[model samples]
Target: MTQAPGGGTAGRWAKRDASVVWHGFTQMSSYLDDAPVVVERAEGHELIDVDGNRYLDAISSLWVNTVGHRVPELDEALRRQLDLVAHSTMLGNTNRVVVEFAEALASVVPVDRPHVLFASDGAAAVEQALRIAFQLWANRGVEGRTSYLAFGGAYHGDTVGALSVGAGGFGTEVFDPLRFPVLRAPGFDDPSCLDVAAAMVAEHAHELAAVVVEPLVQGAAGMQMAGPEGFCELAEVCRRHEVLLICDEVATGFGRTGTLFASEQCGLRPDLLCLGKGITGGYLPLSAAVAAGHVFDAFLGPDPSPRTLHHGHSYGGNALAAAVALRHLQLLEERRVLANVGVRSAQLARLLSAGVAPLPGVGDIRVKGLMVGIDLDPPGPAMRWGRRVCAAAVRRGVLLRPLGDVVVLMPPLTVTAGEIERIVAVLGQAIAEVTAS
Candidate 1:
């Protein structure tokens, strides 16, 4: 292949990026020095960069591509929809695809009676959920029930309201001044943690609007795995306190936790469920805040009043996204993706525990479905170990993104058994190399 203008393959693209594009969550000034990989195209499980390096895409391209890259069904669905309509305001007008998608979602979304309210992404969905829950309380003329309870290591999203309920102990220190105070309990997975959570909710129930949580697992918080016991206890406490229970299943949804939804594993249903990320098979940005029928009733009022839900995005229910999402669901059902996740997840857990757990400096390897977090011990050496190990794995072909010493694996659900073994083997080698060095 002929190289671009400046020098290497990505020279032209790099120059263009340097002059115009400002990437998110990155320091652009030093970006040119490192020169980010320019992906040319993606096959099923691999990404081909401008330099022709093939990466396994083990992180699922930031944990969104649940199935795989260049999925023909999803791509064709988007293309078909694009040929018809690409953009339209979803404020008053509705799309046939969006309506159908909502119908499909309502059938299996865990909530007893679901009414879908679309949004652009996970954070927006979560914000809408929190707003709806609070608004429902307000509409009922409930006095002082306004606060939200959350777990200590919870990470919902980056938006203002999401930042509010998200615990401040993490890297959110800069946003502390801007965040609203939220009641937090111990990490939900800890033993006897339910009692602590219940006590906190009971104390604040009179002033609590909702208790929002990432059901069974908290993703961004180092891919931490919390079992259903804590979630069930929290749900029971919320039920007793009359506080709304909002479950953020953006990461754990769509069979990531070996179930259709993590709530199913725990047998607990929340008043509101926020979903996104893998909702559209990672093809498009689509999210929804699903509320029960009673919660929806709060928004229905006789007059133009505060009971109505005033929050909605212009791309709230895009026809193309919905079509793609609906197709993604059909693909899931047609392929039995949930059962695949369960099988693959068990295989991965066993491989990690048997092959990688004995490595030096390795603390714990927690696996829930495809979401695996291998936590390393100590901050100094282990942090460097994680970075080096991930870099080595990248060299070996798998793309693993580590979170401050925790190497997380969130591969596509369609990954084959051979790919699973390779992934585990590469990770094992990476761990051994890092620790030995």
Candidate 2:
């Protein structure tokens, strides 16, 4: 076995991974040199690799983790659920923990009389929301309302339905044949995004089933953000048109946006809400498609009626995941994690402004709560500045990932002040080193 710099075990694991693992969004041919971090464990907000290198989780393990890793209450919740039962079907029956978690989630999510339909991941949740929105019109005896309205630079998920509505990028162009096109609106990158979207809604309201959005920030679009007022205005336009509004808070939910859900900040009580990522505090895979009372009511009818929305996953509402998610939700309030998010967000803004923004090749820095994106100057095809800078930051013990030329930083809500400083300092140095090269 080839020995890595610090350990042979990591090298062996990497070799084994290269042989058997077909990772998504990765080019397997050059995976070793490009992406080499093999995480062994996590503590608080840091990830320990197999080579004993510790890297601060600046992207919250791809924007899922919230409170921190290995939180005691979350751990205990999983253990408690494991003792009772691990796997149960939510098809015909429901479990206690799932019901309790949904109840807890309903209390916080910005949907009137919310009823949750559990799914295993964000894509599945988004897919559920899309189908629910489509079927709601059919169930209400409404015709021609079969289309959807989505913004450019929007990313809901990777599933077919979600991808159909999503603004296509991320090498998803190859699947263009399979994706069903939606009524496209300009994204937040354009100042007139809301104006353009409202116009589209006004023009197509008769045939549009729903207007789907990422609320205030489109994380996958390099944290492209819209004003909360714009979001409220869009919601009003959707309401005025009598069209459903689906808020995909997969990335902005669970206090990531300084609010439990971004919809809360926008004062949007969406007809359907898609939530995931931090729901289980990164402990397990759990997502929910929450429907308003009216939306849920539309699907109800006599037993075995065709009005029922036919969709489900085998692992939907797993007891352990639900239990951990419930505890995570409780801890969010008890520990006042959102308050930390507000303070840390300010610290991050100041640190980035004072430290990284002046560096060469830095174009723009966008931040909403702890979710951040630092857009680098446009690089030539041969110059992967964002990737190189992130790799440098990783070597310096801060793990950062990039979306093309946009360097993203989505640190855990519980990241300490000192840790935030370290992340910023390392990022600045990394940017300098890469730019100088």
Candidate 3:
């Protein structure tokens, strides 16, 4: 192999990584051919590979990084909390920083009198929400309210409970046996999907305990979106049917969709809300399943009774993560990050429209705030256009990943005008190069 610019080599680093690492959703057989970037350090929104190449983090570090990498305030918050305490179990006991962080979160989340249950990952948050919704009925003496209603393109999480509600794909079909069936509604791509879902809720209200949705955008479904009016109608139906609503905002939370949460735009106050990803500003692993006061009260009973949720995580409320999350929430308001999202969203939309949408290989282009997916249209099934195009972009110093044929671009919320332009330009170049051949 040829020598790299930096003292270390990417090939050498990848070999070391592949020998010891088992990456999720990745095939280890050809991992070396995929040309993964071995990042040694990060500065702001760019990641410097072991070979000394700097690539703009257009995917927001797998859609978790909110403000940017190495944010000074977030770093300080983590360091400050580290000096105080690192880990304290949240089982039957609480941490000061955790309580404070939850209080601040409850104030802003679109849940009424929210009570939070901390977890370690987005999947865990969604799984807990599923368990809570299932048990909320049993605690209230409601019989046969055991099943859930989910949309066609929904992607909740990979856990058994979460996968049960999610529309299966992404090579998860083998888990079909583990996934308990749910009442299915059409995907958001259909104009009348919400109406159909509302009707299904009304019809199946007897056995249905809850309805889980990815409000505004079905992120893992290639960014399929629906109007806010549709969500408003669905919320009304859920209320009328007395079915609990669970909004999985793991992907759309923390100002990623031009608001603090996507539920705000959709006029929803869910009984259960799942939050993660950017909760700690991409600094630490922390997720939360927030239950509305009404739902939370259902689980209250004797100290050692069945009403209590039997679920708890060991590192659920790490003080260090809580401290960073508290500061990250504050930073969102202090820096006016939502205001920046609105500006950058409009700029990104306009540039993508002018530059990429008109390209021959482009199909549907979806945009919701900084989240975007550009579909690639290939005549035959042999071409992996999405993969090849993203590889081309990565080679051009812009980091992007694809959801199958949809090239996803989730730039950090603090992306600048120049960076947005660069992303669009590189995307266009990559698309042209892949489609022409």
User: lDDT winner among the candidates?
Assistant: 3
Clashing pairs in 2: none
Kindly list the per-residue Cα lDDT of model 1 for residues 300-419, writing each as its tens digit: 886678888889998898888999999999999898998899899889988889988887878888888889999877446425666667777876778887877889999999888889
Off by over 4 Å in 3: 1-8
Tens digit per residue, CA lDDT, model 3, 190-290? 99999999999999999999999998999999999888888888899899989999999999999989999999999999999999999988889999999
Query: What is the C-alpha lDDT profile of model 2 across 269-329, one tens digit per residue?
Result: 9999999999999889999999999999999999989899899999999999999999999
Q: For residue 194, give model 2's deviation from the true position in Å.
A: 1.3
User: Which ranking of candidates, highest lDDT first?
Assistant: 3, 2, 1
For all candidates in order, the CA lDDT equals 0.84, 0.91, 0.92
Model 1 has an lDDT value of: 0.84
User: What's the distance in Å from true for residue 270, model 3?
Assistant: 0.5
The C-alpha stretches of model 1 lying farther than 4 A from their native spots are 1-19, 29-35, 378-383
Give the Cα-based TM-score of candidate 2 against the true structure: 0.98
For candidate 1, the 10 contiguous residues with the lowest summed lDDT are: 1-10
